[model samples]
Target: MNADSNGLSNAEALSRLIKYGPNIFRDHHELPLLIQFLSRFKNPLTILLLVASAISAFTGEMTDFVIIMVMVISSVTLDFVQEHRASKAAESLRRSVSVCAIVIRDNKTLEVPLVNVAPGDIVLLSAGDIIPADGFVLEADDFFVKQALLTGESYPVEKKPGPLASDSIDLQSATNAVFMGTPVVSGSAKILAVKTGASTAIGAIADSITRHPPPTSFEISTHRFGLLILRLTILLVLFVLLVNALMHKPLLESFLFAVALAVGLTPELLPMVVSVTLARGAVSMARKQVIVKRLASIQNLGSMDILCTDKTGTLTEARITLQQHVDPQGNGSERVLELAYLNSFFETGLKSPLDEAILDHKNIVVDVWKKIDEIPFDFERRRVSVLVENGESQWLVVKGAPEEIIGLCTCYSVTS
Candidate 1:
């Protein structure tokens, strides 16, 4: 795609849409019809039922044939309808890309649709904002992002403006790269777009969903069982035919008997049973906190020997709280507690559990502090220092990990 003086040219944007837009799973009103048709004969039990019906028809048993055929067709039709409804509901839950973004173009900031945000666009991101595109950070201030959706990490990742090592950097370690779907946990930033739409990291996930292969287990099992039944039915039919041939019996009568045997050998209820089993398993799992996005994932989960999972979100509560406070001065230096409360109260960007606990202090009057200078927290420093001016005096307040803060001060607190 070509870039115009403003950004992407009209032709370029159209070309990108042609290449990438079609891949996006936009909600379609006709999706229900498509899903219904696809669901037929896809389940194992259904396959067996259909095979049984075919055998009954060949046997010349009109009553039995009609009954089996009706049952098979009705079951398949019901399954198709249910699947169609489910697909339509899933489509309704898909996130929309209707919001416009404020981006810098030719040293001028302009608002444009998120879909039109091509690579190399400078996007302005702030606290509580969802990243619109994948990009490299050019500048950031106390920027932290929650990447649980992408990496399954519950903790907010601290981001910095620097050149990331392309060879060694993975998505989690790409300190410079900001991705779509993740929200800015705290602070603001200016980022240069590296990828957008289908080319983005999240876009890769969308592509995986689109190009997913058919259910291997269901297909293989149904085919195997069907072949076995077909072989048995053929043998039974041959035995009857041989006897009829030796006895000089009527050919029509013998053929009808063989067809009846074939029909009985086929398992017409197989599809319905398999469908019910899978649906039951899926519903049971839903009752748990884990949501199985793909139905086939249930089978895959069973086959896994060892699962390597991210510990951030899945294992941790995603909240950091103060477990203990040691006031060694014995004078009950409430000033430290008060200062911590004031600093947390003024911090409008990030809201962690530690900040919540500090805010809960009843004795602290954080609003009394006037205008002042403050230093934002950094992962490397592990501390946040604030200089607040109250009347004529300026108080230097600091809060961080216990070890880091204790190391900076010479005094030690002894418990009674």
Candidate 2:
């Protein structure tokens, strides 16, 4: 089938729609409410308490049964309410990352739901665009994509229209194919959507990121303690029932007495205490501008000896500001900014935070400057250079890490 700027015809798009379903990836294992509630019963302490309550009710000790039931209801209800709120918060966060994209269909470029993007559709991408689907580069101009989500490499990867001879190439080396959720670092491209939703490489990685329980030491110790208590409660209850029966006590009285012993031994109030404390902790965290997605995580967090993670969107706000531009001898210089902005503004490569900051500073009219050639930034080179021709003069501007930028200099200029 031919694919172009017009993309697939309406009939063809519809046909593929039926075949591929939608461009959406659903996390496959969301437990139902009833199952979630039932899962709480898996705890040994909860099971033992429940059994004691049943024995109390069976022996017609309605008051004891009612008291135990109240505790169980209070504990479970608090837990359920807290977890439900947390789940909703997580879903809202996910929605922000999954946004719409523009695709060409029937000769018209239109913004559509990301789910509606299908293979063979033409995706028009520009700088700062977050790619919603994987595709082959049909056309490109100095395009660079940041695939850190997939490749874990901080440097942006350049892409161009080319033929791959084999399927054995690694994803980072697949220079011709674009992946979903990666941002266009700079430049622009007309990409033909080859994979969408779960079929893309990033989608597969996301699919593998199932919500498995965190391996917290506190949880492990708590579980082991519960089992130890379960064993002790069983032995104590059995011994009491045997002794009472041997003494010719009434069966109902003996059962009731044994149930009371089990209740006392099982730490029946612990669950209620934990639930209330965790809920309070969650509220406290929210007040401090920290969102605790799982209330149970509070205990795990408290028990953490050390925790390490990315600082992006966590320790630091993602926004960056241009602080100051200066020359040698610590003198403020507009020329430093002028040169930096010109280098940033003229280059046809991926823009960095430093570049954005420089561009956002007081703008200079560059209508007379003609961009000559650009030397793109790479980790090895540690810089980007832009040469521009203005009137009868031409100047080369370079920007990069401070150490690297200084290393290339033979002389320093100090504003007097």
Candidate 3:
């Protein structure tokens, strides 16, 4: 394996792996068996039970020994199976393939499976698309994106093609960039893929989630409690054996008594309780729209102090309505608004906040005006011009950034 700057390397020549390491397949059918076997011997409660069973056997109480052993094994086995099944189901749901995207390569657009898209591919995105890769915009058509996944902003951001020069530009302010795992809420654009797989920002988050090594509070508590139980059980068994030996008890009877004491002190309920608690937490989180992919994360959520939440979908409604439009001139403001509404109504195959604002105007009737010709909105000029042949003469109406419109205007209107 060859290491990159972040110490990731290719797992195979045919497929790309994260530079950090090859992705481990989480699914393991044998996991349940392994968990059951480990749980029976490793837990303090289970250890106590095992010691008790050994004592019963030594004491010639065959039935008692058999029953205790059976209960311990059965409980661990049930927990192991239940946990494994839930994990498998969660993984299957999360990894199911849903959509494919069109990518541009060699100056041609081609449909490709989303998972197969690698770095350096150009992806063609339309309105309502979920971005497949992290990229930079190559072509944008009145493009706007909802970057709620990356930034908490609720508004759909207008995107353009150019290097934005701002020291404090947020991810949402990256007008020339698009990121992985966010959906295209409106408009269309062609994006040049800059990163893919684990190299992408979203991929990094996934890697972080996977590689987090800190044990949960519950795990820590369980380990400590189990250790304490194990030590105490060993000491008590030793004390009993010493007393029996000092009392000149028969060899076989003394051995049996020691085994019984060990079995009695083992904690057989701890593993079952832990499994049940995790399962209950998973169900509870699911009810709150938070799917628990990893069982260990259940306890971690309880200990979290700061939760970064996306503001768009999580806090606000997705729809953006025009609150109000400022018209400095009072006289022809209504006319300008009417023209703007009419032009937007007639235009087809385009969607934007400006267009939506025009269409949603309550006072204007868009069908009343007839269109003559229109100069489409250009980002370079930062304006849209429309000529409407209303009544006798044609009226040239334009609306855009106030500063840009002011420079082009020879008249003024003051709103009363």
Candidate 4:
């Protein structure tokens, strides 16, 4: 789709929606409650305890069997309940955020739910907005995107509309294309959606992680502990059986003694203890406004001594501050700052970090300046202009990259 042409009509968008499906990763779909509850039984410690309870039942020790089974069921149920609550809380938190996309439909721009975005739709992206689908840029204006999710690059990359080189094969080289899940760090763009749902790059990555996630440290440790316990129990039981056989003890008494020893060696309350601990951790984190869908992840996070994560929003505050505004002589200039504030404040496009910094640096009284017209920032010109009239006179204020703006200046202001 070209910039001048109206995007896909309403009927065509509907047809494409049916063909492409909703724009979602699908990995977060909730499993059936029964299936989720049953999954708790798959824990190694729980399974081992269940086995011990089975041996108790087989040995005609009904009291011991009942006790062990009760403890195991209680632990599993507790864990399942805690995780289910956490999942519900997370879902509620997610629903609280309105995830919608602006798309061009039937010659008008409309904000629709993210899932409604389909192939052939023209999506509008602005600063602080995550790209909703994989698409080619139809128009761009100093558009910079944080593609750390896809490229692992800490710096934001500039994107513009153009034909890519023949050697452009990786995500980093696709300057004309945008992918889902990456946030627009600055500027604005209009893109033609070409891929949605699981077909998008981030969706495929999410699917891979969901299907073959590596076992967490908690899982691995529990499995090893369970196996260790099983090995020790087996060795002790065999040693006791050997001694009893050598001594020629009564068969029924010896068998009962071995069974009793095995049952005693098993840690029936281990599952309950772990589940309780994890549940408490989950509740503590939830109180801090951190929603945890998996109780085990709390342990994982606690165990981390040095976390190596992206710098976008994890290690640093996601904000930009204006340190100084100066003229060519490197001296502070209130005039320059006010002009920048006027230019940024009057522009109607998505506000970038620089614009926000300018507006927030100092409060300037703009009641006298009436906005007339604006030339929105674009990649080609690398600048934004605002036409302002102050009753008797009119002034055109411009802000942009240093080199671009300097190239257009006939004279430079050394001081106020």
Off by over 4 Å in 2: 1-5, 27-31, 93-98, 163-173, 211-221, 245-254, 288-293, 308-416
TM-score comparison, 1 vs 2, better candidate? 1
The digit string of per-residue lDDT tens for model 4 on 103-222 reads: 988889999999899888889999999899999998988788989788776557788998997999899889999999899988899998888989999989877865635778987898
lDDT, candidate 1, equals 0.69
Where is model 1 more than 4 Å wrong at Cα? 1-39, 42-60, 95-97, 106-108, 165-168, 214-219, 243-250, 276-308, 327-343, 357-373, 387-395, 401-407
Candidate 2 C-alpha lDDT tens digits along 1-416: 36777888768877886788788775676789888888877776777778878877887878878888888878988888788887788778878775777878888878877888888889889989988788899898878998877766666788888886476378778888899889998889999998877888877877776556665665567678878888998898899989988999998788777777886666768889888998999998889877776677888777788778653444454456988887787778888888988998997646776777778877888999999998988655878889998889999898888899888889987564
> Lowest summed lDDT over 10 consecutive residues: which window, candidate 2?
310-319
**Least accurate 10 contiguous residues by lDDT in model 4:** 310-319
RMSD of each: 5.0, 5.6, 7.0, 4.9
Model 4 residue 402 distance off true place after TM-score fit, in angstroms? 1.5
- When sorted by lDDT, best at the front, the candidate numbers are 4, 2, 1, 3
**Least accurate 10 contiguous residues by lDDT in model 3:** 3-12
Q: Residue 29 error for model 3, in Å?
A: 12
- Which lDDT value does model 4 have at 261? 92
lDDT of 3 by residue, 280-318 (tens): 887887688765655666878788899886454676665
Estimate the overall C-alpha local distance difference test score of candidate 3: 0.68
The 0-to-1 C-alpha lDDT of every candidate, in the order given, reads 0.69, 0.81, 0.68, 0.84
Query: In model 2, what lDDT does residue 168 have?
Result: 37
